[model samples]
Target chain A: MPSDALPDDPLPSWHDGRTKRAILDFIARVTKQGGPDYAPPAERIAVFDNDGTLWAEKPVYFQAQFALDEIARKAKENPALARQEPYRSVLAKDLKALTADNHKGLLQTLAVTHANMTTEEFASRVQDWLKTARHPVTKRPYTEMVYQPQLELLALLGKTGFRTFIVSGGGVEFMRVFADKVYGVPPERVVGSSDVVTFRMGKDGKPELYKTAKVEFVDDGPGKPVGINRFIGRRPILAFGNSDGDLQMLQYVTGGAGPRLGLLVHHTDGAREWAYDRKSPVGKLDKALDEAGARGWTVVDMKQDWKEVFPPAP
Target chain B: MPSDALPDDPLPSWHDGRTKRAILDFIARVTKQGGPDYAPPAERIAVFDNDGTLWAEKPVYFQAQFALDEIARKAKENPALARQEPYRSVLAKDLKALTADNHKGLLQTLAVTHANMTTEEFASRVQDWLKTARHPVTKRPYTEMVYQPQLELLALLGKTGFRTFIVSGGGVEFMRVFADKVYGVPPERVVGSSDVVTFRMGKDGKPELYKTAKVEFVDDGPGKPVGINRFIGRRPILAFGNSDGDLQMLQYVTGGAGPRLGLLVHHTDGAREWAYDRKSPVGKLDKALDEAGARGWTVVDMKQDWKEVFPPAP
Candidate 1:
C-alpha cells in the first residue's frame, strides 16, 4: 500500500507553515546529489543554539535556575551567605537585581554556584541534577521540556547526514549531562561557555582537571561565531537560534557562501509557553526580530508554527 | 580467485612487528560485540598527534617553516625586521635560541606571523601557503610528506567505526587546511593550539570572526589532556603520538577505566626520515620514551615496522 505522504518530511511536530516549508525546501535543495545546490555529506554541518531554541528558557535559563537552587540550598546551611552580595540578591529572588549592569551580578552568582570543583565533580553534579531537576512552572523534568519540533528537526538532519552541534551560552558541563540523551548530540559536538580548567597530577599520582572561577570562554552573541570557528573549525551550513544572543551566529551561518539556513524561534505562544521578548532579560529577542526579515531568515512563531510545545511525557 | 591473507589487515604499509600485532589485537578486543572488552562505536574515539607522528618534522614543524618564509618575505621589503629580537634569532638559524626558556622566542615568532587576521583571512592564508610550500629536505610538497603507514591506520580505524581526530600542538587553523586531504580527518575533528577569536559584524553589516594576537589555548604536553577534554570530551580508547608533547595525552587516554591502546612512533629510520630524539629540539621524544615500557604502550620502530616511509610523490 502506497502512502500519500513523503518519508523525507522530517519535522512532523511542526505545523504546515511558511517556516516549515522553507526548512524542508532548503534541506531538499542542498541534499540533492548531481544537482546545482548539492553539498556533500561532509559539508552538511548544522549548529544549534540551546536555551530558548532547543528547550524552554522562559522565567530564566535552566542553568540559572540550578545556580539559584544551589545558592538557596547553601544559604540554608550557611547563614552568612545571605549577607554576601550575589548570594543576597539571589536569596531575595531578585531577578532584576541579578540582571542589572549587563549581568555582572549573574556572573558572580554563576562563579559561586558552578566553579571551585574538579571537572569530573562538576559533571557528576550536573548529571545528578538532570536525573531529577524539574522546570519551575511546568513541573516536568528539564529534559522533557525540550521542543518536540526541534528534536524532530535534529533527528531528520542526522538521518540526512547532517552533523548537528549545540553551541550555547550555557555551561558546557551542565549541557553535556543531557545533550546526548535528549538531543542526540554527543558531548564533543556540544560547545558552551566554560570555566578555566587546569590539568595537573593529583597527590596520588593520577591526572586531574580542576574548574576555576575564572571564565575561559563565553559562547554568547559575538562569542558564538568565535566558539564555532575555534571548536568546529568549519562554517556551519545551517544555524537555528533565538534571542539577541544568537544574532551573530545567524549572520555567520546564513552569510556564508552557500545554500544555508538561519532560523529564529519566536516565542509567541502565551498559553503553551511564555511569550515575552525585548522587555524581558531572559532570551531577549529585540534586534534579531527586527533584522530577521531583512536577513531573509525564517522566523518560527511558537504559536502559529509549532503544533505542540513539549512532547508527551514518557 | 582470492588472496589467502586476511582482508581485515588494514596496515599494509606497515611491516609485521610487535607494534602492528598489538594494534590489531587491541582493535579486535574492543570491537567484538557482547564481549567484556566491547566498546560501542561512539566510545571508540582515537586521537593522533600531527607533525612527527603524521608527517616528517625533521627540518622543523611545517608551520615553523611557513613563519620563516613569511619573515623572510617581510624582511625582503623591510630590512629592519632582520634586527628584531625573534627575527634576528630566526635569521641566525639558531635552534637553541628558539627553544630557550620553554620556547618563549618561538611563541613570539608565532604571534607575529599567525595573528591579527580574520579567521577567514587566516584560513585563506594557510590554504594559499599549502598550495606552494615545499619540504626543506625532500623538496616535496609538505602534504606529500605525510607517513603512508599512519594514513592507512587512520582509514582502517574509520572503517571499524572509530572516530579519528588529530590532536596536535600545531595551530588549529593551519592544520585544518590540510587535515582532510592528508589524513582523512575532517576539519571538525582536528584539535590544536589556537589564537583567540572574536565575532563581530564588519562594515558591510555581515558577521566576521577575527583572530586576535593573544594566545588562547595551547594543546601540548599538559595542555594536551585539557585540549582532549575540552574538544573531544571523551577519553580516547586509542592514542598515537611521537614526541614528549603527547605525554600527558598518552597518560590521559590509558589512565581511563577501560581497554586502551597508546602507541609511540619512534623515528628509527634515519635514512628514510631524520632520526633525533633526546638532543633534538624539534619533536623531542625524551621522557615519553623513558616511560613507554613501564606503561605497556607499544613503541613502533620506524626502521623495522615501516616498509615504506612517505607515499609516492605525485
Candidate 2:
C-alpha cells in the first residue's frame, strides 16, 4: 500500500521544536482524508486572536495607537479641543491618566475619535492611517510588525483547507481595513468589538451606515465566544491567542466534540519583542497561561519556537 | 473571435419572460470575465429574503407558526399554562387576538418560546420541529414549501460565482438548523434577527451559549442593511425579496457602484398559492410593490413567470 506523501516544511521561520511539531501533526491529522481526525473543508475552521498573537502589541494595542493618532489629528485641527480632560491627557501622552478610572477616560476619547461618521468615511480614515502610521518603538509601519512564523502557519493551514478568521478585541471596522491586505483574512471573517451602526438614506439617496458613539459589543475575555457564535455560527476546531482575553475562546474551541487544538503565543523574547505577559496592562496572559498548562494547550515560546519574529525588514 | 459561450438555462421552473430574461442577463454580465460589468467571485454577492421570497409564507410567517406550535405543545404539557392571555389566544388559534395591539400577544408568545435555553437546545428543538412540522394549508413539510424557481435561481447564482446569503426576519438559529440541508447555504451565510446569547461554563466544564429574551438585532426594513454590513461587510450586487421587509436591502444592493439586480416575487397566483399584498397582515408587499415599478426592479408575476411554484411532489 502507498503511504501518504509528506509535504515540505511549510513553516521555515518556525524552529524544529515541540511547539512546531504539535501544530504540524494537528494540521496533518485534520487534513488527512478518510482519517479518524479528518475534518471536512467547511468544518476546518481556525480562529486567531490579533494584537499580541499575530502582531506585536507593545506599549499599547495598535488600535489604541490609532485612536490616539485620531485624537492628535483632531487636536491639531482645533487646539481648544485639546484642553478637554481626555484630550489633554491623550495629547500629553499620559497613559496613566487615560487608563485611570477603569479606562473611563480612554473610552471617552475613543467615542469622540471613532464615531459619528459614515462607515465608508471611517474605513477611508483607517486606510489613510495605515498608510502613514508607524510603531512608536520600532518606527516601522505597524502592518510590517506582524509575526512571520504565524504567517507561514496561516498559509499552511489555508493550504490544508482551514478557513482562518481573526477574532480580535480591536474595533471591527479598524481591523477590516488591514485584515485582508496584512493577514489574508477578509473583512467578513474579522469579528471584533463594535459600535452601533445606524442605516439611513444619504443625501444622494444611497444607503449609508453611520457609525455611532454607542458601544454595542466588546469582543474580549468571555465575549470572544459570543462574537464567534454570533458571526461564524459554528465552533472553530482550532484557536490561538496570546492573553487572558482569549481564555473563553480557547475553552470553547477545544471543548467542542472533535479533534481540536488550543495554542497560545507566549511573548518571551524581551530583546526581539516586549515580554511582559502576566503583568502587562495590554494583552495580559496570566489566567490563560495557567489554563493552557492544565488543558494541555500548545504554548509557543517566542524566543525558542520562532527563528524570526517580523518578516525580514522588507 | 469566438463569442463567450452561454451556459445552459439554470432556471427551468422559471418561464421564458421579462423577469426570467432580466435575471439571466444580470447573471451573464456579472460572470463574463473582462466584460465591463464583470465582478470577481469574491465580490459577486447575492442576498435573498427568506420568508416570502425563497419559500411560501401565506397563513403566517413559518417562524410564527413554529412559535405557535411550541405554545400549543407547552400548553399540552401543562394545561394550566394555556389559561394565560397570550397562551389562551394562541391555544385557541386566534391569530386576530394574538396579532392585535401591535402583536403584543404574539411578541409575548415568541419571547417565551424562543428564549431561555442553550443554543444547542434551541437548535435541537428547531430540528425536531422541522422533522414533524407541516404547512397549515399545503400539508407538506414546511421545508418542502420553498419555491422551486427560487431554489433554481439560488443554484444558478452559486454556479455563476455569486456567494448567496439569506437575510431574513426569522430567528437566525431557527433558519440555521436547516439552512444547509434545505438552501445549500452554510450556517454562517444565514443572517437574520437574533436575540442576545450569553456565554458561560456549563455543568460539564464546557462552554455553552444561553439564549436570552433580550432582542439583539432585527434584520428587517432598515435593519437589513445594518445586518448586511455586520455579517457580509460588502454590498451585494443582486437582492431578491417579495415584500416591504426587504425594501431597504433592495435599495442598498441596487444602489451599489456597479451592475445590479433587484427582483421581487409577486404572489399573484390565487389558486396555486395565497395572494395578498397591500392589506395583508403578513408579508405585506405594499410599499415595495409600488417602488418596484419606479425602480425598474424585476417583478415576477407568480402566475405567469413560474411554470411551477413548489418542487414536484417528492
Maximum-DockQ candidate: 2
Off by over 4 Å in 1: A1-8, A73-108, B1-8, B75-108, B203-205
Over B1-314, each residue of candidate 1 has an lDDT whose tens digit, in order, gives 01243364678888987778898888888888887899998899999999899998868788888888877766777999889868888888887998899998887788777887787887887787788888877889999989999988998788777999999999999999989988889998999999888887788877788888788889999899899889888778999999999999898898888799999999888899987887888989999999899998899999999998999877
Which candidate number would show the highest TM-score if scored against the true structure?
2
- Clashing residue pairs in all predictions, respectively, total 0, 0
Best by lDDT: 2
| DockQ of candidate 2 compared with the true complex | 0.77
lDDT of 2 by residue, A1-314 (tens): 01234346789999998999999889878888899998998898899999999998888788888888999988899999999878899889898998889988888888887999999999998888888999988899999999999998888787778899999998998888888889888877899999999988999888899999999999998899999999989999999999999999999999999899999999999999978788888889999999998998999999999999999787
What's the true lDDT of residue A147 in model 2?
A: 99
TM-score of chain A of each: 0.92, 0.95
lDDT of 2 by residue, B158-260 (tens): 7777789999998898899988888899887999999999999889878899999899999999999999998888888999998899999998888888899
Worst 10 residues of 2 chain A by lDDT: A1-10
Candidate 2 regions off by >4 Å? Answer: A1-7, A95-104, B1-7, B84-86, B94-104
